[model samples]
Target: MTKTKTLRIDHVKHPMGLLSVHVFWCVAFIVIPLLFILYYMMIDGNGSLTLDNIKYLGSKEILRCFGRSLIYAAASTAVCLLLGYPLALIISRMPTRRQTTMNMLIMIPMWVSFIIRTYTIKNIFNDNGIINQLLRSMHILEKEGDFVKFLGTPGLIIFGMVYNFLPYMVVPIVTSLTGIDNRLFEASADLGASPWKTLLHVTLPLSRAGIISGITMVFVPAVSTFYISSTLSGGTVTLIGDKIETAFLNESNFSRGSALSFVLMILIIISMLIMNKFGDRNVEGVAV
Candidate 1:
C-alpha cells in the first residue's frame, strides 16, 4: 500500500494530438468553405440576404440538369450493385491469398488519375478509335465512318460511371461479406436451405450496411461528376454538375454556382437518409 505507482498515459496523449489535428483541418477547410458557400448562396448581388439565388433552381435548365443527374446517379448505382455484389461474393469465398491478388487487380485501375481514365474511355469510344478500327477490320463497318457511335450517348455516360466507380462498390461489399460468420452458412444448410436461399435470407440481410455504404459512395460521386459527363457525353448531355461548373467557370457567377451546389448537397443528404432508412429496415427484418 505504501509503494503506489502512477501510470503515465502517453498513448492517450498521441491519440488526443491526432484528434486535435483532424478537428483543426475539418474546421479550417470543410466547415469554413461550406459556410462561405452558404453565405454566397443566400445573398444577392448587393450582398443582402435574399432567396433569389435559391429561386433560380426553378429555371427549366436547372430542373432538367437536376433530373438528368438523378437518373444517371440511380442507373449507375443500380448497375454497380448488380455487377459488384456477385463479384464481392465470389471474392469473399476465395482463398485468402487469391482473394488478395484479385482484389489488388480490381483496384489497380483506381491508382491512375480519374481524368486520364475518362479520357481513355472517350478515346476507345470515339468514331475513329479502337472500337471503330476493330469493326472496320472485321468488315462490320462498311466504311471508316460507318462504325457504331458509342460516345455522346446516355448509355456511354452510364458506362463510364459504372466502370470508374465499380471498385468503390465492390470493396465495401467484400468487406461485409467476409465478416459474415461461416457457421451461419452451415446453419442454413442444416436447415435445408439452398445456397441461393441462404444468400437471399442471410447473406444479403447481413450485407445491407455495406450495400448502403457502397451506394452512397458511388451515387454521390456519380451525381457530381462533371468531367466524366462532359468528356463522354461530348456536350450532348448536361448534368447538374455541368451546370455548376459552367456557372462558376464560364459565367463567373459564384452566387448561382453556390446555390446549385447547396441544392445538390441537399439532394444528396436526402438520398443518403432514404438509403439509411432502408438499411435500418433491412436490419430490423433480419433481427426478427
Candidate 2:
C-alpha cells in the first residue's frame, strides 16, 4: 500500500515568522494610525489633555454638516440598492460570456483613479459641457452663460455618489445571486409560487448578506467623501468629510479633526448595527 502523506501545522517551519510579519504590518499601518488619531483626539494645541475636542462636536454647524452627510449617504445608498438589485439580477441571469462582458462594462470605470473619474464627471456636468452644448445646439439656450446649472447642486452630489458607488452595490449582489442554487428557485416555482412571490421569498432572503455588505461598502465611503462634494458642489454643499478636512487643513486643528474622525467611526458602527438587525429581522420574517 502507498503511504499517505498529510501536511500538518506542527510540521510547518517558521509559522510564527509568517504571523509576525502580518502582526508587524497591522501594527505599522492600522494600529499605529488609529492610536495616533486617539492620542490627537485627546490633546489640545498646548499639548495638554483636554475634552474640548469631544465637546466641539455638539456645535450647531458641525452637527448640521454631520446630518447632511448622513442624509446624503443614506440617499445614495438607497438609490444604489434600488438600481443595482435589479441590474445585478439581470446580469446574473445572462449566459456566461454575456455576464463577463456586462461585468467588464460595469467595472471598466473603476480601473481608473476615482480622481480622474470625478474630474470627468465635473467636465460632463459643468457649464459649457456636453449636456449644455447639446442643449444649446438644439436651441434650448441662446446665451453662453445660460448653462443648465447642473454643477454645485445637491442632486449632482447624489448623482456622483450613485455613479461611483453603484458598482460596489451591484457586484456583491451579483456574486450572492449567482452563488444561489438554481434548484432552490425551481423548487419555489414547483411549489406553485408566482415569479414575484418566489423572488420575494427566495431571491431576496438569500441576498440579504450581500445587501448588507453593499450598504456598508457604499455608505461608509459616501458619507465620508470630501472630494466629490468639493469638486461637484464648488463649496456650496459640505458633508462631514469636508468638515473634517477643513478642520485639519484650513483651520489647522488636528485635535478637532481627530475627534470628528472618531465620531464618524462611531456613527458608521451604529448605522451598521441597525442595518444588520434590520436585515436579520427581514430574513426571519421571510423564513417564517
Which candidate leads the pack in lDDT? 1
lDDT of 2 at 225: 96
TM values, all candidates: 0.91, 0.91
Flag regions of model 1 displaced more than 4 Å.
Answer: 1-22
lDDT of each: 0.91, 0.90
Global local distance difference test of model 2? 0.90
lDDT tens per residue, model 1, 173-193: 999998999999999999999
- TM-score between model 1 and native: 0.91
lDDT per residue, candidate 2, 1-288, as tens digits?
111222233437746644665677889999999998999999999989999888889999889989999999999999999999999999999998998898889999888888888889999998889989998999889886788999988899999999989999998898889999999999999999999999998998999889899999999999999999889988899889998999999999999999999999999999999999999999888778
**Model 2 / residue 194 / CA error / Å:** 2.5
lDDT of 1 at 99: 90
Best candidate (score: TM-score)? 1
**lDDT of candidate 1 at residue 160, scale 0 to 100:** 96
